[model samples]
Target: MTELLTVDGTQSALSQRYSSALMNTFGAPKRVLVRGEGAYLWDADGNKYLDLLGGLAVNCLGHAHPFVVSAVTSQLATLGHVSNFFASAPQIALAEKLLGLFDAPGKVFFTNSGTEANEAAFKITRRTGRTKIVSTVGAFHGRSMGALAVTWKPAYRELFAPLPGDVEFVPYGDAEALAAAVDDETAAVVLEPIQGENGVVVPPAGYLQAARRITSEHGALLWIDEIQTGIGRTGTWFAFEAEGITPDLVTVAKGLGAGIPIGACIGLGAAADLLQPGNHGTTFGGNPVAAIAGLAVLTVIERDGLLAQVNAVGNHLASSIIALDHRLIAGVRGRGLLLAIELTQPVSDQVAQLALEAGFVINNPIPNALRLAPPYILSKADADSFVAALPGLLDQVEAG
Candidate 1:
């Protein structure tokens, strides 16, 4: 057993240890979280906090869900890791389940994370015999070389020079811009149903349908990056369902396994056959453990009717936050549980810090945006508590 230590002492020790052993990729740690349940997390000193960001929208079922835990534990005892050379029941079952979620005929390629899923999709796009791929400005697909080539963030791409060429970027949600970007040479047009990293930015109505139309006109694949929006995060099984369009290719992760680390690249209709047997593969992509975790997440989401719950709770939360009438609050953006509180001033980081001190966790993706992506199972009372505290948190930030 370990002895208890003060919060500051424990946090400082962990930070020092991490700095000495780990790379400075993500900077210092915020706090040392010891435990989590549902929508709340406990720091080492026993300070409880409502987790509003849900680990960047990856913890749809929240931390340590019974279903996920049981599924992972059982799968590990039954069959843990297996090479791609052999097939597992959970793997095939998950693939079928993911394909069924689209309510269409398609194939799936599993991966360990969203970036790898995008990488696989990138390779599939190359199979179209066209080299050019058009993605939106302010769009984030992944960080790997192939996916990074399509990503628009200069800060991330600038350091990694000479990325895979033949990629173009156009303004997101601008139908005319996207229409002009895609041509016969374009292999695919990629987009996010709602941009999560970019302050939970929501595109104009019919934007996705417009992408589908434009890509169809140019004989290019329409790829929707649902890595941050899929698996009922946005109150729908897939965010694209609300757009009323079928994308040829879809990349998903984040919430699919409810923090179990799983991702998939799905191809619909003719695009299903784009990647042949020898085209792509991953050794641990379809491992039984991760597949079972994903299956359990889907099962629980359906069994608990969390999709409708997300829509109802998300609307209530947004309305409550807006009704606060705080001077700093500009507006709320995003759909379902994926939400962002737009601030009038560029003090989102301060607001987030204040919220954290007030026993709530939120994210400041940009200078003027505070993002909230609580778990699907988050109770109304918990949400109301956070809403009630928003005005006070904002007041603290404004004072300083």
Candidate 2:
């Protein structure tokens, strides 16, 4: 029989154990979480906290949702996984459903993560007989070699030198810069609509449309990385839907499976058949369990009208924070539940720690940006509570 650990064990003890055993990749964890429900998490010391980050914006239905739980359980009992050679009902159904969300004819290539999805799209772009890819600065596609080539962060790319070349970096949201960078030799123009990891920076109006127009004019494909902003995160099925432009390639992940690992690279129009056989594949992608989980998440979002809820709650939170009139809070950026509170001073790390002490879980994605990507199911009452506590949290950070 295995011995059960008690909550009396302090987080420091666990941190030491983790440091001794695990790789020094993520550094030391802040808390040892035991369980979660809805938008709350309980730590080893029995401290409960409102989870505003929502697993880095991947828990749209909150934690341990009943629909996802039941779907995963039933599907696992019936069919867990099979070779990609054999297709399951849920796999076909999910692909069809995702294509329907686009309201267009397209094909999907499933993967287990956002990086894999970008890698698959990278390969498809290569098939266009062009090697030049125009990407934006401050963009974070993924950590893989191919995806890393397009990511603009120097700290991440400097260590991993000699990445795949022929990729050009342009200033994000600058239509003229993007147009000047692209030509007939460009294979695709990859962009993230909101640049979530870069402190939720939203591009200027019509930026996406300009990219679309420019890519079309240059005979290059337009690829939108919607891994962080898709599937009801931005109060729409896809963020590009608001821009009224059809992209050649769309990559999505994060909240698609409502916590289960799944991602997709969707090729639209003629780009659908770009990758023929023997080009790309995955063993665990599109498996029955993850597909069912994604189906359950989509079903719950539509059935519960979570998109409208997200808009309402997100607006309230943003407005409330702005209403605080605190000198520390510079402004709020982003749409729907994907939001960032820009601080006048570089005290985001302190604010996140203070918020955690106040029973709220938030993230400091950058030095001066506090990001809040709470679940779509976050109640207005909980949002109001967070707003009520914001001023005090800022004061605490300022005091020190």
> Against the unseen true structure, what C-alpha lDDT does each candidate score?
0.92, 0.94
Summarize candidate 1's per-residue lDDT along 47-122 as a digit string, tens digits. Answer: 8999999999999998999989988999899999989989999999999999988766999999999999999999
Could you tell me the lDDT of residue 128 within candidate 1? 95
Tens-digit lDDT track of model 2 for 81-129: 9989999999999999999987569999999999999999999999999
Best by lDDT: 2
Error of 1 at 226 (Å): 0.4
Instruction: Please identify model 1 stretches exceeding 4 Å from their true place.
Output: 1-9
